[model samples]
Target: MSGSSRVLIAEDDVRLAGMLEGLLRSEGFDVEVARDGQRALHLGLTAGFDAIVLDRGLPAVEGLDVLRRLRDSGITTPILVLSALGTAPDRVDGLNAGAEDYVAKPFDIDELVARVRALTRRASAVVPTVRFPGGRLDPESRTVTLDDDTTTALSERESALLELLARRPGQVFSRALLLEEVFAAADDPGVVDTYVHHLRRKFGRSLIETVRGVGYRMGSLS
Candidate 1:
């Protein structure tokens, strides 16, 4: 039971998709559904999720294409392919296309839930801790530890923003880009400034740098 873990279900069968959503929700997982491959790809790239359940017969982009694109873009989220193409070759193709697990159609709902839980557990176990000048950030736990060893938990947005900057220190990121990628096209760009201010107050004023007439970048952790 991956309590509160987020999952994306890219399934086209309306009845099946809705059933899966209700199942995952009852298991205490946060779930989002995309009825087609195009929307699936968009959410897979822009949003963060613990696991993904993708259907091979998706319309618009096809499931394997979507899986390849996500992998090519460096998205490491665990994906389980669910489809009626249950042949040996089909299973091989799904696995070869970067799916962590493959579940054929007519799957037992309980079994599907178990596999998803396993994927989330494995992903959480392997997330690498990011180290910076004066601190370290844990991606799985969303916690930061300063040189003084004071640990603080960050909200999802805060952790995402800080991780983006810290991962590419000194690289500038514009507010528009941040809104699109981090906040998933938030209506107000000012939200970026608000989170930056929150991070500065929690960590320090110098934790991030503002680029005049441009955007923001990682600053000296001091």
Candidate 2:
């Protein structure tokens, strides 16, 4: 949290992102702006940033998904979810998705900067990988192994999506939650189905079951 705390601003709004960037710069924190979810994800995964200011309505990938993916991949950098959806549910969802803190939009730049500093100042904790029936999913490695014999690797998005379903085997995830929790808000809802399809192919057609107009869930290993 010194003059070297790097911050990533994942917001699509040109003006807001820029304003936040300038504010962080003035505060002596190294700042980077990612205008869309793709760039956000790319930078977030490849770069070593200290803290993140994420917008829920990110263009290509929703901010929550980015947060979820980062957490899923063992990137426990401090994160603050910044968005206009300040409803109780929205705040809960963002926090539940893995953000260390949540800041609603139209926020005071000074306050936002303070929160970012607070996040970086806090001590970090290690999040362990998720375990499911007949397999172990190591988010840090982005790999999954089923049946104790073959280990299958997943792509960035695939790993995030599967990690969501894998975290709770019997719990059904609605398409809306999938979009909010795993995919970008601007991303097509059908993208959930597509990823499910791909997961089916990778984990087997029966590994993920469709809930008939509801959503998808991790299928029973038996």
Across 6-99, the per-residue lDDT of candidate 2 in tens digits comes to 8899988898888888888888888999999988887776565778889989888888888887776545577899989999999999989988
Q: List the residue pairs that clash in candidate 1.
A: none
lDDT of 1 at 41: 91
**Which parts of model 1 are misplaced by more than 4 Å?**
1-3, 128-162, 165-222
Give each model's clash number: 0, 1
Alpha-carbon lDDT of model 2:
0.79
Question: What are the runs in model 2 whose C-alpha is more than 4 Å off?
Answer: 1-3, 123-222
Per-model TM-score, in order, reads: 0.63, 0.56
Q: Quote the positional error of residue 216 for candidate 2 in Å.
A: 36
User: Which tens-of-lDDT digit does each residue in 157-199 have in candidate 1?
Assistant: 9998988877556468899988887898589999999999999
